[model samples]
Target: MAFLFPLSTFLLPAGGEYGDVRASFDEAKLNAYLAKSVPAVKAPVTIKQFKSNPTYFLTDARTVSIQTAHQVEREYTMLAAIHNYNSRPTTAPEARVPVPQVFVLCEDKEVIGTPFYIMEFLEGRIFTDMSMPGVPLEVRRECWLSAVRALGALSSLDPKDVGLEILIKSLSKVSLAQAAVKDIDTGEPVGEITGWRELIGWYESNLPDERKTGVRIVHGDYKLDNLIFHPTENRVIGILDWELCTLGSPLADLGNLTQPWVFDLADVGTLMVGFKNNPGAEPISLEDLEREYCRVTRQPYPIVEIGFARSWMLFRLSVIMQGIAARRARGQASSEQAHLYASFFNVLGRLARGVLEDEGYLPKSRAKL
Candidate 1:
């Protein structure tokens, strides 16, 4: 479903207008909830069609109107401030909400046949690049520095304090890794035989035994795009998208942000390059970001470890692309991008091999009969 906006007023119409045929929020119903929850409002509630991932509708008030049937624990979000009618305790009120400010939680299992959540429609923009645009280069590094510091602050939060330890611990399973060792869905790991072999070999051979004990609170999908920056202030206003948020190795968070997205650099320069050329912005390099993050976080450089993690990331991404390719090949998906995304996996696979080779995890010679 494609979204059509007024090009002037970024608001959702009374009915579904933006090629949004899927389950959507009932604005009337949501407004009623908000009106009851908070009495004197400054403006009429307007539900803006927001994210597609969790299928939510954002509002002009920067509060989420979630569509869910199940009762969610209000403690999971900004319930404290919502109940108090005050701002969050952590940051400045004018500063973008430090976290995705979730508002009303409604269920769609009955109304829309699926579940969704809503959050405040933030004022800032997602840069979608390695660098902060519209800022000077001297300050460009500081922008990322503050952004990384925010991430570190988030990581520093006690998992128990946030009640994420129990929730994420339940979700953190190595079954996927175990399954990769032995193909389950397919009769065997086909087309990716070498990739699989290399991955399993590296997992067993290279990773330190102490690595598994270092799990911590992770953003799960900690990429530049997931962060919202106040371009002028040069600080991360809010960290968005908590669906994949969990307690895991901090390396996992760093891996997702630093590791190339979709495909490695050889396959697609656009991932990082796109950040540099973000509208009205000057680009920054990946090296600068990584270095600054390490320095500020006081964490080990972990360059070799990051390299190993990159191989793991590529292997995981390949499985996803191949699945899409299979669907496209079967006419399940129509976009040519699906096919192109699939081929890009091949490039990542080659890059993963290079990573493993440099680490000496890959065999010097392939075993033969």
Candidate 2:
């Protein structure tokens, strides 16, 4: 449906790395003022998820894992991502999503120090694992279905109608400056010695025709863990993390949503969970997920093209992790385990190649490194 990213809930993050960067803001003025501007704000604001009222920094060290920056463009896109989705008419009762209230976007860095916005803090569940530990298996299944159907609802809307047409020009671009990637199995170059541009070409050449699905809102990082589900219900209430929002093929979102199915969750670790061998439950498949999406959108699944999207999504994920590795090397990693990503990217690459072969995008013989 749409390239939705992970499900996440925001809590107030303690002012640390971002504190010094935004020292210019007089909290006495900006703080205590939110209560007056946003009725949703109460005197005592607390942090549950800690993205709660994140203070972003302009420095590279503060580059949030999800494209955090002080640029107005980033804020505009983030606002567009949230506003467009919230503004869309609820075609289905299930499509009604409770999102964090974004009250303002002050571009002038002079206002709250490092260009900040005041938004409501939401309370919900952020399932880091697909297994949805401790939750009933059926509820887990329904939550996944609800996300699918929601994405289907997103796909049904026109970017133009939602006022997101401007995002098409600002689509995220991947740099091909990195060294050539070697095949995980054969230990041979996967593309030309020259650059990744050629490698991208090799896979895309065999992908199904790209025109079928057409353009739609691509969430860029759409996934279950990225969402914020209801506290005790199977439905999605608030959708957060709009840093990666853009306009692209609906398959981009679809491919991302189902990417885990193509790989072994064992390879990635418990941080990620897939339907098959999902920890404590019987193995499941995307048949029902696809069916639900199709039913909501009133369209058949693009089985062939989805392979291309899946491969691309995996590749994109590997690259993101690679970036984390780079950050770790520079001693700017946000997490203590950031260094571990170096080995993970290769597994993702191998998985991508597997999708290409299974989807018939490439001959099995040729796809093997």
Candidate 3:
């Protein structure tokens, strides 16, 4: 017997509709998209029950909440669209996915308040951390390889052919810089910090000085949790999350994926160890993972070349955390680990300064600061 439920209340957002910053999954539209696009899904079934399942697969924001059903469906459709845009042949990897006759939904705005698309749903298990106990070593390695290769394939795509010019054009330099800073969660402007280097220096130094393309499709948040794997098949069923999809340096995407692996080593084993099916079954070393990713992607080993990606990733994280810290400081949100957040701001400031100083982006007069 199959059972489904309304995961959560779909509340009309209270704040300004930021640029996909606080965007969320729209369940009604997701269902409609699937019903219209997929040939097999003829009727929309009523959500029988609604409950939340803790997703060991993602961070707090992406977890299944009141609207999990919608999120699942939305993610499925988005992944499908990306796959189609990539010119991924039906004969391509993980081709068993159902191909819907229709791809677009007409009542997208009415149901989800957005123009939404659809893709066939995939049934698979996800390992947020490659190092899990129940998973075999070989399977874990394959998962890592598949993820890196998928990212490489995505990076190698042609934006014009895939109809991604508009998405890429929508991004602004300020927004990108702000995003880099804001990810640290601090309220301070990146340039104002003392003694610390700016994050931009590191990015500029690490990435190719020349922009390869005006805009390349970027999966803003590329990480293990966002990847879906066909547990038994030893393959990635789909790449998930489109909320942050845009046109930017594909290197940014690569940087994001490998960031956690590089810095934050202290939390790597503890925070990620339990995410996979079995905790501590297969411990993946960062060195091995980095080497494999380089080989599969055919990019120079990032660990050897740029190293800015990791710095960029950390800088972004620090910025995000600082923003959170700032919010907490203002009494906007409660924080048990107030000290941790506070420390994040200081760390971000220092890191940013370090990066800028290293790249000569910081003015000579303020070298000490």
TM-score versus the correct structure, for each prediction: 0.67, 0.74, 0.60
For TM-score, the strongest prediction is 2
Better of 1 and 2 by TM-score: 2
Q: lDDT of each structure?
A: 0.49, 0.55, 0.47
Q: Against the hidden true structure, what lDDT does model 3 obtain?
A: 0.47
| Candidate 3 regions with alpha-carbon error over 4 angstroms | 1-40, 48-81, 86-109, 112-119, 166-197, 201-207, 210-215, 264-291, 297-305, 330-345, 348-369
Per-residue lDDT over 8-100 for candidate 1, one digit per residue giving the tens place of the 0 to 100 score: 231112122232324444556555555665433323455444333323444443344443423233323533232232254764343222664
Name the runs in model 2 displaced over 4 angstroms.
Answer: 1-25, 32-98, 166-175, 178-198, 203-211, 274-284, 365-369
TM-score of 3: 0.60
CA RMSD (A), model 3? 9.6
Clashes of each: 13, 20, 31
In model 2, the worst 10-residue window by lDDT is 59-68
Which regions of candidate 1 deviate over 4 angstroms? 1-26, 35-44, 50-97, 129-136, 166-190, 208-213, 260-266, 269-288, 302-304, 334-336, 363-369
| Decoy 1 TM-score against native | 0.67
